[model samples]
Target: MAIGDILVDVQAVAKHYGDGETRVDALRQVDLQVRAGEVIALLGPSGSGKTTLLNIIGCILDPSSGRVMLDGEPVFDGKWLRSDLRRLRLDKIGFIFQAHNLLPFLTAAENVSLVLDLAGWPADKGKERARELLDYLEVGHRAGVKPALLSGGEAQRVAIARALANRPRIILADEPTAALDSKRAQLVMDLLRKLATEQEASILTVTHDEKIFDRFDRLIHLRDGRLVDE
Candidate 1:
């Protein structure tokens, strides 16, 4: 894609459940554009279609209409454009959720390294890379600790390290800081902002917290499956 052009594009997208009169509109002609290295926030209340939009952007679900392009490729054209979306997901996207989701059996470093290994990186290199990322995120000291032994904030940081393990082109985080206190939430937001700017990765976050709204480059609000002016 050309520099400054959209790294992500969702044009006239819509999603629905059921059929005929019983249908529920989960998304309504939602049009969105994300540039590389920018952070965008999707804000809304419950049932506002924020998750639907994020799922579509992540290529986890297909839109009922319209199109989606990633890195200038037509990945979604109202249907499953690629047969191996799982591979694409593994290679191009990283996801963080409200919960840390780290395996209880693994150390912080292992959690990150495992993803790299699954992506075909050599074990030695993956371990080295994982260490680098954890250190960069300031969680290096917790590397040998497992989730059960780490604090909530520390586990969340490990989750972020895992998300960055594959060096994805886009990062989609759903309520990443929901479980943290204000101070920790601010720290996570700052880290996301820095990563987006420094790594040139497009980030779209779904969140209810208003405190970090100003940290985003763009904010899109949704209500009842429709876009509202922010």
Candidate 2:
């Protein structure tokens, strides 16, 4: 509502890879806004820049041109403004990748606790919060299990808990349900929607799971690195 209240904003953003004969435009003058307590789906085919846009928004990649402000803070103006971008990411942005990226040696609870600890939480508090999130996500029973021992759905849930351990303002998910079956995917989507609404955090997900598109507050379509509406 207010100017400083926007969770995520991208204005005239663009990204290109390679040079000359090998050039590829990953994003083209993209404009997007995500507000608190809302979930947005970036829907498009491969090469449509869905993930590219997500990366830009998450501060994983800098846009070639334009601006990206997170929670009213100008982190990028084509080039990153914050010298400690990694710290900013850890503090404000949570990331869920398709790979689940959990530490192989750590149990599910430990994986989640690691993040909280890194964010300056006390060891006991971090573990307690991790357990809380795991229970909230219905993964409490598997909290002691390792990634190799967990199902695709369980692993993903753990990854989500790890992402949320820091209580970030924004959650950026890239194909979060890619590894799950339809039923599990639906369950995850439902959980994501509920989390965004209940936590008052903004969620931006890049997904090809069209069956769950109706669950999101908004859907922004992309084609050939550009926004398109039907």
Candidate 3:
């Protein structure tokens, strides 16, 4: 993809759950976009709808009303535009979470390989791809170790490698550095920026850690489910 191409386009999105007393507005008329090779941080308070917006952009959650475009293709408009959201997510989107969520029984390389395996790659090919990614993320030395044996930061890199295995156009991370210390948090942020730059992938991360704010190219601040000026 071209570096400046719009990879993720969210238009006038709104999301709410329940009704009356139980009503909860998760997002409100939100308009967002992430260009290829750009890294953006989504910031908000506990109930400020950061994750909701991220989920909508990642196609993990449906908005009450909106249009969502992924890699220049409409994937959602009021409802799903594609019947196979799972396939869409796998092919076009990469997801990272607060926890590494790596399989305890699998080695770091195997964890990354599993994603490629599910995408119909041969086991041997998947292993090679995993190694390449681990090497790129500077975690090659720990490729053979299990998640339980790896340090917090090391395990996160494995998780990131898994996310990148498919070479997705968009990468959505939710509190990716929440579990890391200040130094490690900064390291992960730097790695993400590098990934976006070299891979030409749009990166959006939901973060509460203010210490890493300076690491992002742009910041989207949300308050009461609405975008607020920074």
In what order do the candidates fall by lDDT, top score first? 3, 1, 2
Residue range with the least summed lDDT across 10 consecutive positions in model 2:
1-10
Using lDDT as the measure, name the better of candidate 2 and candidate 3.
Answer: 3
Candidates 1 and 2 compared by TM-score, better number: 1
Off by over 4 Å in 1: 1-3
Off by over 4 Å in 2: 1-4
Q: Candidate 3 on 85-204: residue-level lDDT in tens?
A: 988988888889898899999999999999998888999999999999999888999999999999889988899999999999899999999999999999999999999988999999
What is the per-residue lDDT of model 1 for residues 2-113, given as tens digits with 9 covering 90 to 100? 3356888889999999999999999999888899888889988899999999999888877899899887788988677899998888888999989989999999999999
Clashing pairs in 2: none
The C-alpha TM-scores of every prediction are 0.96, 0.95, 0.97
* Candidate 2 residue-wise lDDT at 26: 93
Among these predictions, the greatest lDDT belongs to 3
Q: Model 2: per-residue lDDT, tens digit, 17-90?
A: 99999999999998888888888899988889998898888888879999999987988986899998789989
Whole-model lDDT per candidate: 0.90, 0.89, 0.91
